[model samples]
Target chain A: MTISVLVVDDSPIARKMIRKALPADWDISIQEAGDGDEALAIYRSGGIDVIFLDLTMPRMDGFTLLEKLQQDDLNCFVIVVSADVQPGARERAMKLGAIEFVPKPIDPQALREVLREYGVMV
Target chain B: MSELLLNDDQTAALQEIANIGMGQAGNSLARIWGEFVALSVPRIATVAAARLPELIQRCVGDGRVSAARLLFHGAMRGEALVVISAADRRTLGSLMGFPAPAGDGDPGAQLLHIAETLAGACLGGIARQFEATIGFGAPALIGEDLPARAVVRADTLGVDLALCLEVRFRVEARSLAAHLVMLMPRQEVQGLAVLLDRFLCTL
Candidate 1:
């Protein structure tokens, strides 16, 4: 099964970097969103398997989106990818319902391990 | 002194570097100041030195701006200018646990302290990214209600163009805000360009 992934960040370069991190050969369909609102729209549209999120954004942040997902009881596999590596940020994101936290610029090896461990990739 | 030319990738990468630095800076202030900080997307560009006063004025929003300037030296060297609205200055002492200003409690001193921590953390954050070491000079406080351009006089830095990074931080709990900008003169911008290239290769 091809994993459907959404890369959400305000920086085009940052989204591009995240794209480079994913295995080129992996069977994955990728979509991009500039902020939480766009990502939420795509999420509501369905078929999104994993969300790589960024914390600080223009309209609705990752933490807010996470809260919304929780409030709606939306089943989500959110992995926060942020430059804000503060300890509090990580704890807050997790409390709101993110499955994993990856610091920027994305470490491909760690991300791969996360994908494999979660069975998103065989 | 030439136009600081940068391609699209270089420009985007520079902004990301500034964003990463801003994140670390926000984390430091939030941890020590006991407030959540909301960061604006950083504005990165190369601007002519002539337009600086106008640019600085726009960032602070009013001439009665309180500012602290610090010089940072490293493989990459530049100056950091942090300006807080006089309106927001009233909240600083209490936020950092400093007592009421008694009479005219060295507001200058207080502003310098905040700038040192905020700007130092930001530069330190950027250094960690480049795997470089940076040392900061003492913080200097500009007078209250001074023009923002007073922070840098034309004859002082002597460069016709500069690489600039500007970011705003909002204190979520108190609704206070600070405008922070970092600038490197012509020579250092060339160095920064090379560093941006190395960062992109890794990406």
Candidate 2:
């Protein structure tokens, strides 16, 4: 089975960058969402194994989405992506049940490490 | 009346801080645009609120000017204004591989958004250096005709010293130009300078 991943961000460019950074031969099926509401809708449809979420977005931020997902007991790995690398942002993401926090301008090597640790890639 | 002026040391320190912040902002922009960005050494200047219009006109010269206003509040309080020329905007967009849109309203909005984002990144870098929380308000776009005096209020915000940096950057191998003006209350500037000096001494 292909590893299904959902990428959530308000910026089309940011999403594009993240998509480009992912390994080409990772057997991954990619999905996209512009905000938290769209992400929730896609999550409910099932078959999603991992989520790459952006912190600053309109119509529902990453933290709210993570909270809702946890409250509802939805089973999916979550990775936060944000431009604001303030002191508490990463810590807050971890506390909210995020598997990892990826700083923006996405680094391909960092993505690979996170994917490997999550068992999404070998 | 002559405007209040900073001495040589104060000016140098302020310029150094601005340069560091601009460098960080350039790095952030490069990351967002998915390309390398290089910035020229920043030029520093200071002007009183009353003389701002003439200063802007002289600074911009014959080039077309676009101004965006953002308010930053935290340990350091004031406005962070970004002004870029039309030619520079095209250069920046090209370097980032983003096509300049044709429509008037859309282009204006996009340019203003970019200015706001740049101001946020630059000011955010400065805030990080100072170990402070910075909040940004919405950006307002202004025309060349608008008086700079009207754009910034002197009494309402309680700014002590206004620090401005003229910045130039190249993206995608094209030169782009802009300015970053940060207004800080006098007390904050003195306090911050002392703290930074102490920190540097310890280092």
Candidate 3:
């Protein structure tokens, strides 16, 4: 089965960085969303297997998206990729049902490890 | 700033949080400029709201500065002000693909855009740490003048504690020093200080 991933962030540069950091070896279909609203639309189409989410955005934020995901019981692994590295941020993202939290500027090694831990990569 | 409001532990905790926030802010700039951005160790200060203007002057010194002032609202409410000297403003403008002096349109507007971008980057990073969302008001440009003077003219929000930091940002051969001043109500700051201490204790 081909894995599908969604990279959601307001910054085009950041979204591109996230996409670049993905494991190049995987059979992955990557997607992009600039905000939570767009992300929701993409997510509802049901091809995404993993989501890389960002917290701060203009039209609907990651938090609200997480809430909606929980309410709707969407079964997809979520990894928050954001610049908000404050202590509580990680905790909040975890509490909101994210499987993992990655602080940004997209560390490729970190991304690999997270993907491996979740068995998204062998 | 009569009494030292934050104790040693609290001060250290706040400093750590500020460092994380600044680091994220630096990363944001690095992406924008496509160069490594150097962020200095931030010096955090807790001052009375009434004394904030005085404190700004002391740090800003005699030179006129262009400040971008954006008010933030969330679990805490206040303002985030980024101040840069006029000399640095021209340098940064040119770096951002604008002509030096950025004269195509209102120079103040151009500077204000930079200010808002930088300030948003910094505060957005900080707010994530608190697990809170901070909404920024439309950014207003405070032209070449003392930050305090511009803030006084533009804002009427009652601020009680100002968390001030002197952060130096460098990109390649060019460097710009700017101030990130977060104005919070006394009660809100105290609450944050307490929260920081608790977070540290857990660590």
Which candidate number maximizes DockQ? 1
Q: Candidate 2, residues B37-151: lDDT per residue as tens digits?
A: 5444455565555455555556555556667777777755666667666666545554444555653334556556676767887877666655676888888776543443344
DockQ of 3: 0.04
Report iRMS values in order.
1.5, 14.3, 13.2
Off by over 4 Å in 3: A1-122, B99-104, B145-161
Worst 10 residues of 3 chain B by lDDT: B146-155
Looking at candidate 3, what is the lDDT of residue A52? 95
Q: Write the per-residue lDDT of candidate 1 for residues A58-100, one digit (tens) a residue.
A: 7888889898888867675888999887778899999998888
Q: Chain B alone, TM-score of each model?
A: 0.92, 0.72, 0.80
TM-score of each: 0.89, 0.50, 0.56
Q: B1-203 in candidate 3: lDDT tens per residue?
A: 25665776766655555655776777666655555664555566777666666666665555667787788777556777777766666666555665544254356766667667767777776666667777888988755655444544323545555556555555545656666676665656777776666655644
Evaluated at residue A61, the lDDT of candidate 3 is 79
Q: How big is the positional error of residue B113 in model 1, measured in Å on the Cα after superposition? A: 1.8
Candidate 3 structure quality by residue, lDDT tens digits, A58-122 = 66878889999998797899999876654455677799999998876568899999999989888
lDDT per residue for candidate 2 within A74-104, as digits (tens), equals 6989998766454355777788899998876
Candidate that beats the other on TM-score, 2 or 3, i.e. the better one: 3
| TM-score between candidate 3 and the true structure | 0.56
If the candidates were sorted by their lDDT against the true structure, best first, what order would they fall in? 1, 3, 2
What are the per-residue Cα lDDT tens digits for candidate 1 across B62-94?
556788899999877999988988778878887
